[model samples]
Target chain A: MRGTMLYAPFDIRFQELPDPVILEPTDAIIRTVATCVCGSDLWSYRGITPFTEPHPMGHEYVGVVEEIGADVTGIQPGQFVIGSFATSDNTCPNCRNGAQSRCIHGNFMSTCQATSIRIPLADGTLVPTPDQPSPGLIPSLLTLSDVMGTGWYAAVAAQVVRGGTAVVVGDGAVGLCGVLAARELGASRIIAMSRHEARQKLALEFGATDIVSERGDDGVEAVRELTKGIGADSVLECVGTAESMKQAVRCTRAGGSLGYVGVPHGVELNGEQLFRALIGVRGGPAPVRRFLPDLITRVLEGRINPGKVFDMTLPLDQVAEAYAAMDQRRAIKVLLQP
Target chain B: MRGTMLYAPFDIRFQELPDPVILEPTDAIIRTVATCVCGSDLWSYRGITPFTEPHPMGHEYVGVVEEIGADVTGIQPGQFVIGSFATSDNTCPNCRNGAQSRCIHGNFMSTCQATSIRIPLADGTLVPTPDQPSPGLIPSLLTLSDVMGTGWYAAVAAQVVRGGTAVVVGDGAVGLCGVLAARELGASRIIAMSRHEARQKLALEFGATDIVSERGDDGVEAVRELTKGIGADSVLECVGTAESMKQAVRCTRAGGSLGYVGVPHGVELNGEQLFRALIGVRGGPAPVRRFLPDLITRVLEGRINPGKVFDMTLPLDQVAEAYAAMDQRRAIKVLLQP
Candidate 1:
């Protein structure tokens, strides 16, 4: 099997690797149907998130089951399926609470960039589509494995409600999906913060009702101006930097909620500031498995087109180019055919 | 008029001060019916929160309207009322959103220990009782001004629901009140973390089904054990120190909620930890005004008895002793009468 690995900063390699097989009774091997690079992948590739040694990359994929462990009964070979970036048994206390990302028996999927991958907790992790999806729906269905699911969790965590106003603070693929999620959740007004023309256009298409290009304090002022000085009822912090988190907090009105899905990299929140603002904050790795079923339905039914976030697509063998394009800001996201 | 002044650390003095008079059209001067020493007052009293000059002390009070400015319409002179420690216009965006403590036209009351207090936004800040209460009910009604209301807010913020499990992290007056609040909200298992025998007894009386005398890591472990190793569904953080906040977070289950009502001092939260835990946190000064009406009804009907938290009583002139008792931990809370 072939797979992508991160050798060093700015270094990605597409090389032959050992084939995956069922290692446990609850494991299954899947032949990758489609896979993609993620914004988080850039964290290690840029040396921002240091790594001591090279490792397999990618956590998003749509695949067809190739083999199943003896104990896996809910799914079978030849079935098309999707799973969360984080694998969960789905019956643990945390999973039952809708926090599958924190499931005691769960681990994040990191080798999905390979042509074939082994999935643990197979019966609990993967959800099969109604049927083998057509090629046109593959990209959108692939998103359900991570980005789209994360965006849905963000809107849910922010408590976005019908007639409420929403502010999305990042313009990346996940942020764009968040705009769609907020709209689907019935947020009456959606504000997309971005300075990029192309992303802004996509945000508008995803249901953003307003756009504020300014950053920092100026950006907060713009949101306030648009909200009658009340700020937004719900703000999604998709960028995990200290600046973005602070801006998101300031953009939320008192008694409003903030849902942050960005993996933090030195974000320290002041207890005093949050207290004074009376903002409810909930964030973390999204429990993607919790939303996978509904999101898959949404995509197959053509209610959403999150695949539009994939501005570029390439053969799986050109995985290096996909990473480079996204790193250089030449592509919002790249869908790779396996 | 006479008032309590904190000239410096450990120097609370009851002395003559200028009488408060209405300075705004929406202001009302109230003669002190009752006021009390708060745990927070000790922050400045202990020099932990410094003051540049001697200032009138106290923010909790149940008073009778003595005079009203020309524009004050809803409240009348001689009416007995209870206002939040933080006054709000109630009509402001934040107040309308149920966060009156962050009202656009709001200010924290600081001179309520004096004979008279000029309450800004009188019509919005003060809630009149159904009628003048008997002396026996005064203490319970007085708690609606701060401590009890704060406890109610903590439970409310933590999203306490029927059959949910709740953990109270402090055993102070507010924490004891939180036990009651959790019970009122229908939590099936209410755990109060405290080592103080007196406080534990009071907590049990307030409907705490369990008491964990341990602190720090052991305390979290105990809560986990009580909660089937999943931690409590809702945690009330009544102590503002970093340690207490951290303990509260650790005691909450993944996807559970925490409401911290403590006025934080030097507390900084690592975003990464909170994110990983998926613990939703919301805290601030309690918007007591928002709960005043319901709490008043509870007290009037004898459904709650939060005033029991005030174990000691003192004449207004003995304000210095009241502070000493609370500071020495000799009294859970002290009620002062004018």
Candidate 2:
């Protein structure tokens, strides 16, 4: 099988890799249906998140089970399923509490940007579609594995509820999906802070009632203005930069909640000012598995098509072009069909 | 009536301030039976929090209602009561949602520390005690007005529960009380991170199962070791410093909650890193009024005496000494009597 591997900065390549197998009774092998490049992958791609030898390079995927371990209880071969960017034993205390991403034995999925892959704790990590999803819904279903699920968790963590105001910072795929999730969670007002016209339109389509085409201080002011000078009732910080985080806090009301799902870069949380500001801050690596099932349903029901975030698509062999599109900001998320 | 006034960093004076009267239709006048300096007050005295011209400083008090406005409905004159540090109308959405400290028209009562003080929104702010409280319970009951209530809120915000482990990251009255609060909340293991013998002893007496004398990184390690390499299920951050906040975040389990009530000092929140960290953070100024009624009952019934935090007592005239002792770290909290 061939998979994407990165040996160093700007060194991504698709090369032959050993085929995967069921290493344990709880492991299962899946033939990749669709995979996508994530914004987080770019960090390591740029060599900021350092590494060693070439390693498997993807974490998001939707596919049909090619083989199932004997211990796998709920899933079988040929069943379409959406698995999270990370694997979790859903029975753990943390997993049971809706924090599957932080489960005691949580494992990052072996990069799924390959023809074939092995998933551990298959019964706990994979959620099968009630029925085989049609090929047209493949891309949308694949998104529920990571970006879409993450956006949903951001909305939930921020506690955005019916009739409340929700603000999302960052124009990435996660942010756009957050706009949809906030609306689905019943937020009466959804504000998307973005600059790209295409992204803005998508945000609006996904339920953003307002848009702030500014960043940093100006962005905070713009959000406050839209919120009647009180700031947003909930803020989803989807960009990991320090500036974006600061903007997230500044744009939230005194007692509002800030749900953050960004892969932080150069961010520093100072305790004193944050405590005085009085906003509750939550969110870590999202429990994507927690939302995958419901998100898949939403995709199947045609309530949303989050895969529209992938403006460009390519064959698995065109992985390099996919990376370039996302890196250059020409695309939000680039999908690959294996 | 005489009251203690903070004139400068080190200058506190006893002055014959004007007698307080019911200034608003919802206000009442109370004759204080007991009053004490708050942990926040010492911040100014220690030159950490800025000093303003003649800041009338006390915020914690328990007393008998001397008079009530015609419209005051829930409370009446002659009632023994304890109120929150910040008075709330308790009718706004914020208050209705249990965040009384952020009430729409809330007022901090630190400015009215005199023997006779006017309580705003008296019907909503004050909590009734029995007609008579045992003399021995006065100190503890007085604590319910702020310190104990604040501590309890911290514990509650941290989500402490039965069969769980908790860590308190401050040694002030609030943090010490958090140890008591954690126990009362049914936390199975209570860890008080304190180096001071006085506070440490009090923590143990208040049900702390262990004490970590270290701070920051070392302290986090100790807590992890105690919790079998995982961390406390909850962490109560009661100190406003950056270091303490970091410890609160560091000592919590991956999915555990950190409830904080520390007045933030220069702290900044990094959304990205925090998103990857083990804990979830929530909390702000304690809604003491919301918890005071129940705490006052416990105090009156001899269930707790959190006022042991006031190690020294002084006449109103010794206001300078009272501030000096607490500011210099010689006392936990100072009791000022008229």
TM-score of 2: 0.87
Flag regions of model 1 displaced more than 4 Å. none
* Pairs clashing within candidate 1: none
lDDT of 1 at B241: 94
lDDT tens digits, residues B158-180, model 2? Answer: 88999889999999999999999
TM-score, every prediction: 0.98, 0.87
Per-residue C-alpha lDDT of model 2 across residues A1-338, encoded as one tens digit per residue: 99998878778899999999888999999999999899999988888898888877999998889999889988989898889888998998778767788878888875799999899989999999888888889888888888999899889878799999999999899999999999999999999999999999999999999999998888888998888776788999898887888899898886788888888778776555555545777888888888877787789899999888888899998998888888888888899988
Identify the candidate with maximal TM-score. 1
TM-score of chain B of 1: 0.99
- RMSD in Å for all candidates: 1.2, 3.6
Please provide, for model 1 over B84-139, each residue's C-alpha lDDT reduced to its tens digit, 9 standing for 90 to 100: 99999999888988999999999999988878788999999999886889999999
